[model samples]
Target chain A: MQETRLDTARIRAARQAIDPVFLDTPLYRCEALEPGLGCAVSVKLETANPVRSFKGRGTELVASLLAGDGRNAVVCASAGNLGQALAWSGRARGLDVTVVASRSAPAAKLERIRAFGARLELVDGDFDLARERAAALARQEGIRLVEDSLDIETCEGAATIGLELADAAPTFDAVLIALGGGAMATGVGHVLKELAPGVEVICVQPLGAPAMTFSWRRRRVVTTDSTDTIADGVAGRRPIPAVLDDLLVVADDAVLVREESIIAGMRLLLEHAGLVAEPSAALGIAAILEDRDRFAGRHVVTIVCGGNVDLDAYHRWIGAAPAHRS
Target chain B: MQETRLDTARIRAARQAIDPVFLDTPLYRCEALEPGLGCAVSVKLETANPVRSFKGRGTELVASLLAGDGRNAVVCASAGNLGQALAWSGRARGLDVTVVASRSAPAAKLERIRAFGARLELVDGDFDLARERAAALARQEGIRLVEDSLDIETCEGAATIGLELADAAPTFDAVLIALGGGAMATGVGHVLKELAPGVEVICVQPLGAPAMTFSWRRRRVVTTDSTDTIADGVAGRRPIPAVLDDLLVVADDAVLVREESIIAGMRLLLEHAGLVAEPSAALGIAAILEDRDRFAGRHVVTIVCGGNVDLDAYHRWIGAAPAHRS
Candidate 1:
């Protein structure tokens, strides 16, 4: 891996520029979910804010950066969460934001992106192709292109989570984060490794979409043909190369969890924790369920990253999971 | 109304001494639920804190006061949220806390109360009898009794919600609160009346527990022989006279919604707003569903006041409510 360029100072500076709404999110003990997970768990809930996701922290920081760059327009490709975050933050910073997404992105997120005052450009292909199209638009329009994990600002913004979790009283033995495009995993992993060297950063991904997990194990870029998972938020077909390099230097371990466990994880959070979490957000909890002994008797922390899900999908997945614990 | 003794000054003062966790909770616009509710809706989520309820704000404030009053012990009657809140705050204040609760209180809450290091005394009958038992225990032990809504500090703590809502944008034409012994309603209603006099405060209660609504309208104490509702958090059998007098002066309207709507409201929050609200927390949203015309075309605000739900009951209610929205 390349010599580490990610610094804790950059994350501290990012925290200084973030919107107050996205800062100081609820980090509390998940008392009800502790017994089932076989560990004392404290969850950093990133869903209760404006966009119902953690994307706001990074996107808002990036938007603030664009405010002074003599730029009024920015383009990005997203499944949904990043688009909503960019749109919300862009509106606050008076930037004209454009989001490119495939036709099959969740309507809930698509609607939110538009509601947040961003121009939506629906593509006829996958998120990767959508990214190519977004780049083409950025080139054609001469606007800034912001991609998650590729942008230093995005990574630094997510690092604030590590800062917060470190300050919390629970001295977590390990932190399990969902491996999406690697922005959150890489950012948080780097900060935690810097602040608390003893803490292990475990990156978790869906078995159906194991690009990042496989890449982290191999210490190189690994791209998958097609992703198949209900956790669309974290189902990345390709891991950003830079993000993978950071993950190799910072991440302690990686695990792939089954699709069934992911659905059960969402149900577990709602039933046991009394909070709603989307499939991607429950990746860490799914990892624990998949291998409880690995986390047994250890204090663990997980980020409930996003809570945006289509109602039909949410209900169907809840029905597919095992019946109530209580 | 006894010349309106409840003052905003007391609420503001209480804010100074609150635990930082309980202050400045998430208050944001619910974009997805706007169409369903027929108005712009903002939700102040009081459930995201340590106690998973708004009771912590009041209990913490009261605990701080108890620290200086030559008191080392306190007793209170609770269904679950209040007991857990008191126990958590008492532990922080280094006080001996005894909680008296009925046998029927939620195990989720009871377990948390015990976990927070409070002595739990379970009674045979309903919550009213539990309150009587708690009062007797307090008298026998010569300890201070902290009753929700009856104590000035408790009401003042809740009033901070109104202060926060007033500070936020998306100004509301009316604010709806679940009437649980009139603590939250009386507190928030008083503050909103003082700060933003144009904003109307509408107190909502379940049809099964209409004591507060009836008493507020009649300007007297109203007692019910039985309270039958799934929203055990706000199921008050008898209205406190002092709370009723305060509500009579502060609240502009009171509405009682059916059980079906309450369950459906919970479903609505999970589906549209992506939140898991307790039956009582969903009270305001249910009221909006019942009388859509009353809130149509007007910006409305509601409090998701608590989220401590029994998993068995939560699953059953989710099954009972109407199926998926998408």
Candidate 2:
């Protein structure tokens, strides 16, 4: 395998470039979760940020760089978290942002993007179609398009998380990351591979949206006819080649978790960890639960990538009693 | 009124003494919540710690000090968060901890305390009765009872929060804190008053449990006949005189919020901030919603003190559709 050159110095710079709100998130040993997983598990709370996701780090770095280069506006297509990140960081950097999201995107996510002062353009098709619209818009003068997984800067921004984890707990046997478009896995994996050479980087995806896992196994991009998963954050049918290339070098293995396991992960996190993690973010925990034999007695770190679920959806997932009219 | 002398130097030392997991929590601008309150609102997420509450800081510090002084076992009475904090920190420092609680204490909280390896004594009475039992137990030879709000060392431990807020945003017009036993309000307020004298420290309590607010108003410890509120964290009928003394010197104003408003605050936090805040933790937000006139156009910081609600209780509070079995 050809090793890609990911600048450690640039990753360090991204740590400095990104807003402080997204940096140094809570990474603590989850005592409540450890017993069930049969291992020492530490959770990095990326959802505690203003955007309720890890996307803010990469998007803020990209937005800052763009704004510094005299850009006035930017556009992106997102399933959810990235759009909100771009909108928030863009608003901070005084740049106008337009997000092209699929009509199927969660209402909570769409509301957050608009709340951050971004223009929303909902496409009638899936996320890929929204990406096409964003790409077409980018060709027009004065507008730059940011593609999350495909963008090197986005991955570089995410590498800062690895830097923090290495500084905090460098001796972890494995780090489990939820794979969506693969930016989080690649970025954090690259940094950990460099800093903590002994640590294994594992990527987890929902069985319904295992494009990245399938592609990684075959050493190429794999396109599925359709994707269906409650974890909308990782519900993708296509894999980007750039993200795949990085994953090949950086990731040790990729695993698929059942949709039922993902739902269980969400409930465990909410009840024990006291975190309202979105379904996508809970995939890492699901992976751990599915393969307890591999993780038993080993120290592991799981990234809670986001928490952007609507209250109603969250209630349904957690099996809580219906809302009362007090 | 004679102002009490709070040690600034000790507070700075406490910032150094506490565990890193409970320090420097995310303090960011809450964009989704701002327009509703008609002000720039920032939230300090104290719930991201291992105990999912701010009580860890104080309990850990007190436990460390006790362990250093050759103490092996400690007793404490708590509604929930504080006991969990003591149990967790005591276990970490190799100290045996016994928590006395009311029989009516939430099952989730009791489970957490047991999970942290603490002995639980359920008294068949209210919190006051539990406290009396704990105090009586503490009088036995070689056993020290750690009271939550009345201990100066606990308050000093909590002062570190103010140090962090001052470092993050020192120019805030005011900071609102939810008052239970008055330790959090006094500790954070004392530091803010010293470092950022211009920032007003406002304390909020539930109307059903207005002991602290009434006592602060009367400049003495005031005991109500009974307490009734869904915010179990702050449901106290008796105010400790020492805590009241600290509040008189540290707090600027104390306010009461309705139970309905507290429920509304929990929903808003869950929907907007993506935090599953307990009713007591939501009191600051409820106060803002109840009195928009005082907070309009001003930059305010609200400390989300804890998140330890059961799933069913949370669903009931947030008015989500009833839980669906898979």
- Best model per DockQ: 2
Q: Which sections of candidate 1 miss by over 4 Å?
A: A1-7, A67-72, A92-96, A117-119, A122-125, A320-326, B1-17, B67-73, B91-96, B114-124, B319-326
DockQ of 2: 0.68
Which lDDT tens digits does candidate 1 get at residues B68-147? 77679999999889999999999998999999998898888899899889999999888889899999999999999998
The TM-score, computed over Cα atoms with residue i paired to residue i, of candidate 2 is 0.97
A102-199, model 1: which lDDT tens digit per residue?
Answer: 88889999999998899999998778888899999999999999988889888888888988887863467899898888888888888888777788
Q: What is the Å distance of residue B191 in model 2 from its true position?
A: 0.6
Candidate 2 chain A: 10-residue stretch with minimal lDDT:
A1-10
Top TM-score prediction, candidate number = 2
Task: Categorize the docking of model 2.
Answer: medium
lDDT of 2: 0.88
lDDT of 1 at B135: 95
Q: Candidate 1 DockQ score? A: 0.35
Task: State fnat for each of the candidate structures.
Answer: 0.34, 0.82
Using lDDT as the measure, the top candidate is 2
For candidate 1, what's the RMSD? 3.8
Quote model 1's TM-score. Answer: 0.90
